[model samples]
Target: MRLTVIGCAGSFPGPDSPASCYLLEADHEGRTWRILLDLGNGALGTLQRFIDPLGVDAVLLSHLHPDHCMDLCGFYVMRSYHPNGAAPPIPVWGPAGTAEQLAAAYGLEDMPGMRATFDFRRYPDAPAGQIGPFSFTATEVVHPVPAYALRVSVGEKVLTFSGDSGPCPALVEAARDADLFLAEASFREVDDNPPDLHLTGRQAGETATAAGARHLVLTHIPAWFDVDTAEDEARAAYDGPLDRARSGAVFDL
Candidate 1:
């Protein structure tokens, strides 16, 4: 399995990267299957550079926040009206009412609204399922909105994504024994921590340690914070292989 970082900026776009987006791909039976973890603001355009936007097999949205899902509007435009031909409906797994939230984001009526370009599936019903060669499980995390963290496994290799979560037991469970933990570090330990929204770099490291993750990749560092400082904080807590998430970085597992 291969994981590609499309964007790593938190809350909004930064000078170096866009919001949050990650691509996970695997090969099985002589065919490659690709899935996108999130499509945040400014991510769709950047995604086109990495892979054909219309070629992704599926998309899994962490939440409805603009920084995490606004690019779906632009993606809809691409899949629905590509001059050559409209792309087939792709499976989109997200929270409840995702269809309505996306419709609102696109400023459309209750009818149609991206349903033509994407097949929307709400989570928790079949939270643990298979997508091509990968098996994935979703668990509710401590975020202000209805958000989830994902654990995807191909054979024995596991990749866990802490999709916009604070310190929560669900996160720990989701990341247990993960090969790589793509955690969000949007807040600072010294800053006035908000309630049930984001995690500090130290907290992210601790979570990785608690879950026994092999490698830790700190992502979602907002532009306001120093990236080096966040890495330092995480290093103080985690003794494993640690690195900050950067656009275009690729990991093989």
Candidate 2:
């Protein structure tokens, strides 16, 4: 399995980072399976830079926030107008209101060419099921909107993605024993203004330690925060391999 960080910015996009998006690819035999964790703002273009836009087989949304799901419109356009127009609809998986949210985002209950463009599937808070080579479980998180952190297992390797959330036990349990934990360290400890929605670097590290994750990759950090200092704070709490995520960073698992 290969994990690619297409974007890793917080709240809004930064000059250097786009937003929140991760691509996971698994190759078995001669077949390839592609999955996207979140398609945040401007991630469609960023995705084109790494892999073919049509190559994506499935999209899983973490939440309805613009920074997490706004790029589906761009993806719709690509699936509708690209030279390879006959491509099959990609399966979109997400939390309960996913279908409605996509309809509202595009301003159409049944938009033109939408049925032909996407095979939409709404997943509940429980273990939904499998998609190709991966199986996953979703747990609700504490966020303004309905959000879920996913635990994905491909073969024997497991990876957890904390979309965006405050420090919560659901996240810790969902990521337990994960080979790689991609968590959000969206704010510095001192900058805890809207304190209940995002996690600080220290909080993220503690979560990683408690989950027993082999490696922790801190993401969703604002551009203004000192990256080195945030990493140091996490290191103080987590003794495992800890690192700050950068745009375009790729991990092979």
Candidate 3:
């Protein structure tokens, strides 16, 4: 499986990167199947630089925050009214009311919404299942809105994605023994940031250490925060390969 960082900025789009979005791809039955993790603000444009919008097979959203899901509206436009024709309804897994939230964003609450282009399925209620070559499990995380962290495995390699979470036991469980852990470090370790909203770099590192993750990729950093400081703080808590996620970065597992 290969993971591509389409965007990793937090809260909002950054100068160098868009908001939270990722692309995961793996070969299944002699064909590569693509899965998009989050289609956040400004990510649709950036995503085109990586792969065709129509080629994505499925989408998994962490929450309804604009930075984590606003681009789905733009994507709906692409899938609904392409020059060729309307594409097939791609499966989408997200928290409860995901379909409604996207409908409101697209100003289609009274219309067809994204139903014509997306097959929406609420998470937690949707049992862990196979999407092409990958098997994934979603666990609720600590966030103001409905959010979840995910553990996805292909063959013997497992990858965990911490979708904008603060320090939480569920995050540790989701990332447990993962070969690669993509964690959010939105807050500074020394700041007096509130709890259960976002994780500090140190907190991210601690979670990875506790989960015994082999490699850590710090992501979802806001533009204001210094990546160097976050990396330093994370290194103090974790003793493994660590890298700050950047747009266009790729990891082959």
Positional deviation of residue 207's Cα in model 1 after best superposition, in angstroms: 0.3
lDDT of each: 0.92, 0.85, 0.92
Give the alpha carbon lDDT tens digit for every residue of 1-253 in model 3. Answer: 9999999999999999999999999999989999988999999999999899899999999888999999999999898889999999999999998998889877787356788789989896894767999899889999999899988999999999999898989999999999999999999968889989998889999999999999999999999989998899899999999999999999999
Error of 2 at 140 (Å): 0.8
Task: List TM-scores for all candidates, in order.
Answer: 0.98, 0.94, 0.98
Question: Which residue pairs in candidate 3 collide?
Answer: none
Instruction: Summarize candidate 1's per-residue lDDT along 109-157 as a digit string, tens digits.
Output: 8678779888999896768778899899889999989999989999999
Name the lDDT value of residue 240 in candidate 2: 96
* Model 2 stretches astray by more than 4 angstroms: 110-113
For residue 178, give model 2's deviation from the true position in Å: 0.6
Model 2 scores worst on lDDT over the 10 consecutive residues at: 108-117
**Is candidate 1 or 2 superior in TM-score?**
1
Candidate 3 lDDT: 0.92
Candidate RMSDs in order:
0.9, 1.7, 0.9
